[model samples]
Target: MRELTTAETVREKGSWLFTVRDQYGELDEVILVPCDNESGSASGQASTDGGVEAWINRCTHEAQRFDTGRGVPMREGRIICPKHGSMFDSCSGYCDNGEAADTTLPSVDISVRNDGRIVLTDDELTFVGEGGIDDNESDGDDGPASTSHIGF
Candidate 1:
């Protein structure tokens, strides 16, 4: 990973980092967060600015990546999975309610450089409220199995 500096943070207000397989290549996208906290018209609302928040997904439950040209974020404040129709809040990247059609999304850690640059790293990411379940993991009945996974 490349070390980020203070000056570089100012240059990239909304910066992103992702791997391109084999650790051979990486891509970054930068956008300016206007006072409204929105980069373009497509995003419905502008959120507050202070810390770094972002969406890391390719599509919604409907399978639509963001329109790079308009800079519209994917599924707005949440990253929804198209395959299972799961929605994960962008801020925490956890499912609001793990219903059949509402699975939680994975969250990547991120940080803000003192100079105002957003830094995304493993340390910055953690599951919201409760971490998402890992494929190799299973939940035991500690609370109330009757209430858990039951939809009203």
Candidate 2:
């Protein structure tokens, strides 16, 4: 497991976007959003008041980058996609409206240490600096890696 950032940093911002290397050494972006219950209480007893939840930064509908521009909007326990106004339950990544109904955002497994260090728990080390793609899935072609982020 690799430490992504300290708990205090997440607490202050409420959410954060970062990139980590997958098991295959490919760069994958993730977003860490703090979860709060209906009572406005955090999930864990950590000093940060809530456990930081991680998810892939892509929107399930059009596969747009949720972390782009102003970033995903959080309301109550849901994340609102800025493009289509789709609302997704932050915890489950479930969307019930817009073009993304009945879908869910990809989730990234993560854990927060007792001392407040958020770390990736998927056996992949979270890269702390810079970003690069070393994906085996990518062909030698230097064309666009994806078309999901188009029309945005």
Candidate 3:
């Protein structure tokens, strides 16, 4: 497994650390965005100092899977949903798409292990952030980017 360049700390409602791990199996990745707050609450929590949050990459129109490429989580801030051009909150997966549904990206149950390693289960990996469409069975042309965002 390789950690993509998309891994970085960001400031949203709280201090969040985002990392996209390339599992390279049935699912191409496990995007982990964890909030570092005193309360560690996902809602109504703000990182007054400076932090970040992360959301899934599912499409807004049909809930199709969106690609984050090698530059995932947008270090500069904001991930444009590749499918519908909707800009989702990279930290929270909330979309301003303005519809009756008011849908947001999916999130995982994140926590720190005893050894200080962020342990995320398979079920948690599947539902990270906003976009919730599975592309595990996508075609060859639909695979994730093979580039690196770190050394760039």
lDDT of each: 0.37, 0.67, 0.42
lDDT of 2 by residue, 4-84 (tens): 786677657656777676667667777777665443322323324235677787778887666663445778778777788
The sequence of per-residue lDDT tens digits that candidate 3 reaches over residues 1-152 is: 22222223222211232333334423333344434444433445563222334344455567544444333433234545555566655545666664313666666444443333333443424423222224333355754566566653
TM-score of each: 0.36, 0.69, 0.44
Models, CA RMSD each = 15.7, 7.7, 10.0
Q: Name the best candidate (by TM-score).
A: 2
**After best superposition, candidate 2 residue 132: deviation in angstroms?**
10
Better of 2 and 3 by TM-score: 2
Pairs of residues at least 3 apart in sequence or in different chains that clash in candidate 1: 61-82, 109-124, 109-125, 110-124
Q: Which runs of model 2 end up more than 4 angstroms from their true locations?
A: 38-49, 124-152
TM-score of candidate 2 against the unseen true structure:
0.69
Off by over 4 Å in 3: 1-29, 33-41, 47-54, 73-76, 98-101, 112-117, 121-152
